[model samples]
Target: MKIMVGLGNPGKQYEHTRHNVGFDVIEELSRRFNIPLDQSKLKGLYGIGFYKGEKVLLLKPLTYMNLSGESIRAVMDYYDIGLEDLLVIYDDLDLPVGKIRLRQKGSAGGHNGIKSTVAHLGTQAFNRIRIGIDRPQNGMSVPDYVLGKFHKEEQLQIQDVVQKSADACEACLERPFIQVMNDFNQ
Candidate 1:
């Protein structure tokens, strides 16, 4: 079994915000595969789908961003999934918009959710799919920026990124995480 966890805050206000890109990717995958993430268990909203003959669990942590680790830990523990069987999707402010970084292991690089997750899992070596949201200008608070919606011009590009991230997720499920990372993280 494989678990793909997308981290984001849940609610109307979080829609289309930079912080919610991971959620958007999961939503895209759900739509593409026609699998509704209406089931609630393991402390999250998730759906079980088959990808290439393997059962894939798609999870959107509903505990919001700060305490997102709870959902991840709960799902993994309940299913007895190893850390290697997990792939976390999240937004990254350090990278430019439209870029992606899929890493096998790394530090959170200042992401609070990832930081909390590292604390819970006792490792920085889990697989991660980092979707770039771009950094805000000088004097702009990161939290505020990430919590805000994108401009009209940025919307289409963001949508494209979301869809591509979904494809990357599928690719990871088909093969190894490194193959997807090497292909997408260029």
Candidate 2:
């Protein structure tokens, strides 16, 4: 089974914020794959279904961004999933808005959610899809910027990237992650 995890905080207040882009991608995947996130367990909202003849579990951790690993670890342990079967989607401050990057493994790059994930998982080797949110402008604090909603113009870009990210996830189900990265990381 393959598990796709999107990192973000829970609650309506965090919805659609830059920091919650990961959740947005997961929602897109859920819709595209016809997977309903109807289960609340292992500290997350998840749906299990088959995609391209492969078992897929779509998860959005309810433990919030910083403690995402707690939920992910529980689910991994319960399902006996290995690092190779995991794909994590999250936002990146370094890339421009609407851009997406895929990496097979790397450091968290100062992302708290990923830091927590690495802490619990005890490794940095895992697939990751990073949707770029860009860094803060106008001297805004990182936290404030990440928690803020996207501008109207940026929303269009975000929509496109969400679709692209979901597409990448679907492709990963059928092909090797490295191939998907090569195709989508452009």
Candidate 3:
């Protein structure tokens, strides 16, 4: 089975914020594949279903961003999932808005969610999809900017990227992750 996790804070207040883009992508995937996130367990909301003949579990960690790894570890242990079968989706401050990057393994790069994930998982080797939110502009504080909602003009781009991210996840179910990265990271 393949596990796809999207990291973000839970609650309506954080919805649609830049930091919650990962959740947005997961929601898109849920909509596309008809996988309802109806189960609340292992510190997350998740659902299991078949996608392209592969068993897939889509998860949104409900422990918020910083403690995301706790939930992930619980689920992983319960399902006996390995690092190679995991795909994490989260926001990236370094990339421009609407852009997505895929990496098989790397450092956390100062992302608290990823840092926590690496700490709990005891390794940095895992599949990841990073959706770019860009760096804060106009001297805004990083936290405020990440927790802020996108400008109206950027909504279209956000929609496009969310759909694209979901598409990449679907592709990964059928093809090697590296191939999906090569095709989507452009």
Candidate 4:
């Protein structure tokens, strides 16, 4: 089975913030596949379904961004999911807005959610999908920048990017990670 976890804070206040793009991607996938993320367990809301003949568990962690690993770890333990079968989606400040990157394994690069995930998982070797939120400029703190909502123009672009990210994720279930990377990492 494949487990896809999206990292974000849980609440209306954090909704639509740049940091919540992970949640946005998961929601988009939920809509695209009719996954119905209505089951609550392991500090997350998840839905299990078949995508392209592969069993998939779609999760939106409710532990918020900073402690997202707790939710992921719990579900992994219960489901016996290994690192290779796990893919985490989250926002990246290193890339420009509306861009997306697929990495087989890497450091968190200052993402608290990824940091916590690495800590709990005891390794940095796992699949990750990073949706760029762009870095803050003009003296804006990183936290403020990530937690802030997107501008109107950015919102439009991000909507399209989120849909693309969702498409990339679905493709992941049907092909090799490297192939998916080659297809979407442009």
TM-score (C-alpha) between model 1 and the true structure: 0.96
- What are the per-residue Cα lDDT tens digits for candidate 4 across 1-186? 999998999999999899999999999888888899999989999999987788899999999898999999999999999899999999999999989999999999999999999999999999999999998989999999999999988988899899989999999988899999999986
List, residue by residue over 91-163, the lDDT tens digit for candidate 1. 9998888888889889989998898789889899999989999999878998899999988888888988898
Report the backbone clash tally of model 3. 0
Which one wins by TM-score: 3 or 4?
Answer: 3
Give the alpha carbon lDDT tens digit for every residue of 32-127 in model 3.
889999999899999998887889999999998999999999999999999999999999999999899999999999899999999999999999
Model 2 residue runs over 4 Å out of place are: none
TM-score of each: 0.96, 0.99, 0.98, 0.98
What TM-score number comes out for model 2? 0.99
Model 4, stretches more than 4 Å misplaced?
none
For candidate 3, give the lDDT: 0.94
For model 3, the superposed segments whose C-alpha errors exceed 4 Å read none
Tally clashing residue pairs in candidate 4: 0
Alpha-carbon deviation at 115 in model 4, angstroms: 0.2
lDDT, residue 77, model 4: 97
> What are the per-model numbers of colliding residue pairs?
0, 0, 0, 0
Best-performing candidate as measured by lDDT? 2
Candidate 4 — worst ten consecutive residues by lDDT sum? Answer: 48-57
Winner of 1 and 2 under TM-score? 2
